[model samples]
Target: MPDQASPAPVSTAIPPHRGGLPDPRHFDPVIFPGAEAGEVWPPTHFNFHAPWMHEAGLGFERDASGGIAVVRSFAHLRLLVDIETAHQLFDLAPGSRDFRLLRLIPAALRCVERIIPGDPMPGPLLDEEEEVPEEHHLYAATTAMVERLAGQAGEEGQALAEAMRRVPPGPGMFEAAVARCITRFGFPMATVAPLARRLQRLANAHARVLATAAAQPDYAAMEKVVLRTRQPLGADRGWVGGGLLTRAMDGLLPQISRPRRASTAILAAAEEAMRRPLPLEAPTRLILEQDGYRDRLLDISVFWRRLSAAWMTVDPDTTDRREIEALARNTLRRLSLTSLYRAPDEP
Candidate 1:
């Protein structure tokens, strides 16, 4: 007989105790639909959008047959099953996380769904609105597009659309409308993708510096500096922090009452830094101490604020629209992918 490979050695070891409960984080994959024995569910993309999803006791992975498996962790046990089974369980146990995840599906489907059929927009028309400046034209076009999309979404969409229409036209109104749309119909990725991308870039640029500051023992002092900027300096207050003597001391300090623009920039940088995940490393005290570091933070802060204001106003002429659109698209795509519904059939 041909030589046979030696049998693999098997070692016997006691599994670690998990506080009197089975470790939901690990399980035999054989029992799960389409999963091979001993496989663990791969992390899903949605986890990045909302890290709390994992904390809320839900997980996702693919089985050996390449089918998605939904894993629910509860009371220290994990139940792995097919999507349909998962949905049924969700229906029976409907929690806040379940509803939140469900909301993403309809919102994402709204994007690719062929509601109008044929052309989403018909041939050019000779209308007064067309005569408006390009910025106004694009803004109106995007707004109209959103209305049409919401109209096709049925009762819920219509209600949201109606609420949006009630808001007066302007950046503030648009901001309100966008907020309502997201809360009711999820994000309108097609419209807001550019802005989201810009925010992501801004977030990336400051992540390291912010992480460093966060790790320092005197980080709280930095926060106080950033927070104090929100209040404008006034003559009535003798001293900024305490009394007349302190005010005199502040006047003697060169950096005290820094230019409004500088303060604004720092505030903006702080806000953006708070929005995303930070890297893991020892704090670089030298980086925080450098004048160049402060300058860089200021520059980014100013740029981010302008970008944000433009977004709120829907300034069509702003060069940053591309980044905004990209951001929106990225967020929408992620939400769409991780949603509960299967991919919609291609038309």
Candidate 2:
């Protein structure tokens, strides 16, 4: 046999672990979806407008100082009735869920005429004539919708529908939507493809976690996905104990029958914990301290810890775990990827 080259030296080099997690820099850096190559996050431009508001018969008035005063509308009372019906039917969060569930608008309008009777909206949405407490209106609206839904699907089905609304119909919904936007709207594919891929990866990871949790409910595996999505590999510092994971667990407090004061305290502690610094190398810490970027560092740190705690301490058997997980995934969609490029704030 031809002389075989000497066996390649088995160089043994172990990856660094910071605070019990692998250095974030060692793995592929987590890119934010919809970001273009070389573009800085929190883009320089902030002047954006929603023409949809005008399309919906809403107009904004400017005050003496040229700031927006109030959103005024001369739309018919029928439109207001439809909106109120939709609000209750969907349990819409003010800005977030309202937009995501617009496809149900037509359904909401049809249901309104049947469920809420004739329009009486020449006055304000609130009514003091109703013999109830200050917050009774809120509950009354929600209760009416729930009762209607229960008639069709029963109470359990209504609950399941409510929980499922937090997420879209499928894992590919986001990617498909982006692809459609690019193709139909003439958006440049070159810039959007990378973002779509990143989002696809995130959606896949989330789906895997959900699938696995359905059967096994592995906290360690869930934590890995959360950390990988939130932080890059081989970074100077890594996530440690009880940070964002703790915060996410705090969100579950309302589901339990905890006292209001105790819930508030627990939430407060989670908020404080999220702001604590990550475990940094001694030299890196010294440099950051010397550079007067401590506050900026803290802000940047917030992004690194963003989704890491999402499923921590979660009970797989919790009645609303699916709902909470959907909400956590929605966070990635709603928030900007501001931490991808961490530059020190100007002093």
Which candidate comes out best when scored by TM-score?
Answer: 2
lDDT of 1: 0.32
What's each prediction's TM-score? Answer: 0.15, 0.20
In each prediction, how many residue pairs overlap at the backbone (N, C-alpha, C within less than 3 A)? 15, 12
Model 2 lDDT per residue over 1-347, tens place: 99989989996654744323333333223332322468432222211233343243332222344222223345332223332223343343322322222312222221122211122221101111112112222232223322333354433334322433333445334445455546555556665455445433423322222221121212233343344323321231333532543355444332222122222332233223223343211124323332222222222223232222223322232213333335344333323332322232222
lDDT of 1 by residue, 19-75 (tens): 222222222111111223464322122222333443554544444553344445576
lDDT of each: 0.32, 0.31
lDDT, residue 111, candidate 2: 15
Who wins the lDDT comparison?
Answer: 1
